[model samples]
Target chain A: MRDRPATEARILEAAQAILIAAGPGGFGVNAVAREAGVDKQLIYRYYGGLDGLLEALGVRLAQWWQEKLMAGLPQTPVENYGELIELLALQLLHIVRSEPLALQSLLWELTGSESFVKSLSASRARAYGAWMAGVRGGLEPPEDVDAPAINALLIAAISQIALAGRQADTIIGLPTNDPATWDRLEKSLLRLVRGVYARP
Target chain B: MRDRPATEARILEAAQAILIAAGPGGFGVNAVAREAGVDKQLIYRYYGGLDGLLEALGVRLAQWWQEKLMAGLPQTPVENYGELIELLALQLLHIVRSEPLALQSLLWELTGSESFVKSLSASRARAYGAWMAGVRGGLEPPEDVDAPAINALLIAAISQIALAGRQADTIIGLPTNDPATWDRLEKSLLRLVRGVYARP
Candidate 1:
């Protein structure tokens, strides 16, 4: 019945809250059921248990990223190509910063059991790669820029930003969340993009 | 006597093993003593207790980073310029790839009860700033390069590379630890350095 789907969603929502609160512990069917305000049996029937619920949550997160990244893709070739690259960087940074849960889920995936990796397609990976490729394509290059290596470096740089968390300004002696910081990041990223595709 | 120092080191070593094996929960003093093959009271006597030991560990880790980063200061404007930047990036990536415990410790510091941020000092910040300024001074910029922004971007990018972990390669669609990856990273970095500071 319709109640079954509703019950499943409620359980997942409760599970996320619990996961965030407890942090690698405190994930239990009883706790989730209580938080969801549903019968424990209903959770079991809906999600097949805790593992099923977590698997579902992971899939949901991946889909969320896909949609978010695809929001402002370039539809044409002549619209300030550099702006497109900056927009994507800003959008990605905004999503990761605003939704701490997204980063948390990614961290969970990194430390997740092998079964979790097996079940999920590397959708997040693909999306990030495509984005990088787009940035490379948009570059206004000079001779001697190495495209492939720049792509690798950009990937490495972005990964570091994602993992360093938003508080890097405090940790690394920089200002946190300043417009200047984003401006610096975007300009540097463009240079990489341009550097990669510049004619040798 | 030297026995005291050995006992302290043994306690710290044991703490590391226990934390790795059992996660943070396994860090009880008694457990650490058992793992270290020392008396539990000795742990209290030397490090004062669990919290104290972790504090010491943090200081040791920070000291290690300071030494490693300062290992290769560029001696001349020409010699120290681009290579210094590459060396910093390489060292950062190596640490993030190999010693994940450092990241774990940093993550804990953010959420930790002990307030690690308080440990950051103005003098230390100035020292770091001075070193960065020195690195930048070696560069001679092209007419169009945004030198200050480029310097800031490189520092942020390097930190981000360290944070991204396995996701770096996944984002870039390459293997994480390949020599080819580092080569690409170096090239991209060199391009950024050159783009920002190369004389026209």
Candidate 2:
């Protein structure tokens, strides 16, 4: 009774851990109780139901996106547009590559048409957009730059490569599993960024 | 008795149709027999089994890629690198958006780990690389431009949008279902091209 907040926090953290590890499919009250070391009845009492637990988790995930995604980055505004993109893009690539939640959420977003997933997608979209904007800071490209489109393209490319590479080592013989390939990709990306985005 | 060539052609065509429409999951000897309007035994007798038929269909698909993917494009090389990429990216968008086969093949390639799909992926990769090279013709980007990376990014972006747009009306509030969004993407892509790739 005295540690209600601590208990709830433990439950939510466990829930998030499962969600990241196995995605939506593996989410279950039984698993949560087991992982959180709480009785199943406790979950029912604290959250009212499985849906309630899920909803709260969604909110928590959103807040975490802001905190974790924002903290410890180079916050100084980058005047060099190309370098800014490279920095932001590399950050995105690192997260997507290492974070199972991002990939799982993406898969769940695309596959599920349910209202729950839709709402989740909407919130994620907002969070992601905000994250991008926050990371970008005061960096502004020249008048001729199409920042939005370029950003979308870079995100799409990085995401697809990461997603597709999960099933195989190579996407179109690119050997995506190799770090050297990423280096090549980075080298090329930097070159293009330098070429297109004006140097400050 | 006299139409062995035609009957074989019909069966192969039906197989391709099924592969495109239903992907690998719907592929069945019985389905092919029914679609081709021939006895199931004929498929076994002619192709020597389903594997043979699949192999033949793979060959036919490769040939069709050469014939159809290459036909009627502006073969004339554009010295302007930006315009060249825009042209190719648009074509990829068009095909992926319109052709169920391309989408199906992509799905099949990613999801299936069997030898058959791997072979199909390999052949398709060869054909795609060839088509890209053939399309570029004599055009060349400046030494500063990272053409390969840019090309990979462009293809990834176009493909991801088209693929994800299959399930939902929008991707991260992009309104991908609308044609105008594509236009905006195009406008931005061209701008990036101009910014990066030098003029003729």
Q: Which one wins on TM-score?
A: 1
Highest-DockQ candidate: 2
lDDT of 2 by residue, A48-143 (tens): 878788778767766665565565356676656567677767776777778777776665554445456666756756765676676665657777
Per-prediction DockQ = 0.33, 0.34
- First chain TM-score for all predictions: 0.69, 0.78
**lDDT (10s digit) by residue, model 1, range A29-117:** 88888888888887667777767777777677667777777765656553443355445656666676567666565455444444554
True contacts kept of each: 0.26, 0.45
For model 1, how does the per-residue alpha-carbon lDDT over B117-199 read when each residue is reduced to its tens digit?
33522223444455556576545445465544455456546544444433333433545567766566656676666554442
lDDT of 2 at A101: 71
Q: Model 1, chain B: what is the TM-score?
A: 0.64
- Model 2 has an lDDT value of 0.71
10 residues in a row with least lDDT, candidate 1 chain A: A163-172
Worst lDDT 10-window in candidate 2 chain A: A107-116
User: TM-score of chain A for candidate 1?
Assistant: 0.69
